[model samples]
Target: MREYNVAILGATGAVGTRLIEQLEKSSIPVKAVKLLASKRSAGKVLQFNGQDVVVEEATPESFDDVDIVLASAGGAASKKFLPEAVKRGAVAVDNTSAFRMDPEVPLVVPEVNEKAIYDHKGIIANPNCSTIQMVVALKPIEDVAGLKQVIVSTYQAGSGAGQTAIAELDHQAQQHLNGEKMTADIFPVKSAKKHYPLAYNLLPQIDVFEEDGSTHEEWKMVHETKKIMEGDMNSDAVKVNATCVRVPVVIGHGESVFFEVEDSSKLTPAKVKELMQNGAGITLQDDPDNQIYPQPINAEGSTQTFVGRIREDQENPGSYNMWVVSDNLLKGAAANTVQIAEKLVEHDLVRVPAEYYGK
Candidate 1:
């Protein structure tokens, strides 16, 4: 049993905190744990394996002698610190979108593309939280019956935006209940000029809108699905489209996914359910007669992707629909990021080039 030294880059934040919890219970033997955050969060003590670990300011030097780096900082911070960690000989599994689409970095969901982890050049990118759940449900189907197209509409949770967004949702709900004015500031992109209240209402946008009218969140789903499934965005084999929305939920993300199977005659709703039931990291909850199905409330803290509402489109026999749910913070961000690190260790891919060591 070999133990490895690990560092968590954003140890005080929502996803960062979850990463700590996941690592605590993980099968990987952790010799030492380092908690790194920004200067403001430094000196905060977090619990790991029944010991107090103080958060330190993240710098290139923080990666010294670390074997694995689990990074959940924001995109800017990840873009800055992850490379430094890699350069310092630590294999960084990143939860931010900073390096996902980079050809040199591997964007991996362990259940979907574990082999991709071996191809990493010192850094592995974790796909967007929404993309991770959708792909988990779709991967088995894609294998049993070739996938031709995918269309997904997501009802995302406030936690996807971080702790501030979740807290704002709670505050706004209280304001609505007390007949006070609801404030808008975080949902639908915090940096955008216009913000909206997500309490008892839905916003049809997740990230900032692109030039093509699609929000950045939707674009990530579109492109990331392709990258994870076929490993190339331009692959003519499969097409993906998404509409991401922010709902008032606090933890889990719910999605309605419609997909077309290339070989329609063989793949049916029952077969799809059977495939998913046996799929890794997936739980089949489709029992229409008993009113059993996946829901956000039921999936709050679970790591497995809950899938239900399996049915084929009546008009198009080739097209089918299903519902998917998972905790956005756990499986979507922290759990998946940690899973990539686990895969790296399992496959003995945790080491980088010699030049990166002590450089």
Candidate 2:
């Protein structure tokens, strides 16, 4: 097998760290590993294959000689550097929302849309963490029955924000334990005018709200799901609605999903479980009698999306309800990013397509 030079952007952050760790266990034929972060993280040393690799400050020239770039940096960095990386001959799997809705960029969830990796001009987008797990859980059903509508309520982990938010959650927990007023800093939105404590509390907001009163995170879930499953970014082919909330957990994200199948409108819970059992990259945990449903703690480190609590919606004949859970950092971002890179290699799409040059 031939090897490719891989780069990890935002190499010091939560998702970036997981990207490095995921690459260690991944099957990509990696010739060399390069770690890229901001200047503060540049001198830091990290490990891949048990050897030390120094993190470098990312620049436009960072993509030179890099075959694959797994980027989990902020949207700003991705918007600025990914195009340069592509121009310099590297195919990037971006884990930011910067280009997800772009008509030319394919927002991919490996289990749901592996074939979409071939459509990359220079960048393949890893869907949002919440969107990734939801699509993985939905793909099996969408494959068998056609999707009509999807409504998801997410219990997102603080780690979804970044390492700082997770740490702040811990601090707030301690403060509450000691009867001190908890301080607010990163939760909700960092740059927003106000912040809130996430310990023993849920923030109904995930990101700053848009003009329509929906947070950006919620909007991503809606549109990203449509693009990945239906390949129609703005089309109502599969109606997606999301309510994103920040839970007190540190790593795993849990979602309550209700979906209606168009083709198999009469699809029962049993059939749903059967599809999930045979579904790629998903685990079935639907034994309610034994209290064995998917939960965030149990899904803390696993790459597979966990689905359970399957039942038919009583009010709606064609609708079913279920719970989906996965490690936000793993299958949601880093693992999904690396999986796209693996698919790219499997399909020999290491270079930007000439057709995408003008995009």
lDDT of each: 0.89, 0.89
Give the clash count for model 1: 0
Q: Give per-residue CA lDDT, model 2, range 291-313, as digits (tens).
A: 99998889988999999999998
Error of 1 at 165 (Å): 0.8
Task: Please count the clashing residue pairs in each candidate, in the order shown.
Answer: 0, 0
Worst 10 residues of 1 by lDDT: 230-239
Which 10-residue window in model 2 sums to the lowest lDDT? 228-237
lDDT for residue 87 in candidate 2, whole number 0-100: 87
- State every prediction's TM-score relative to the real structure: 0.97, 0.97
Residues 1-359, candidate 1: write the lDDT tens digits.
Answer: 66899999999888999999999878778999999999999999999989999899998899999999999888899888877888878899999988888878888988888887766789889999999999999989888888899989999999999988999999999999999999988887889999889999999988888999999999999888888987622346578889998999999999999999889987978899899999999999999999999998999878999999999999999899999999999899999988888888788888996644224
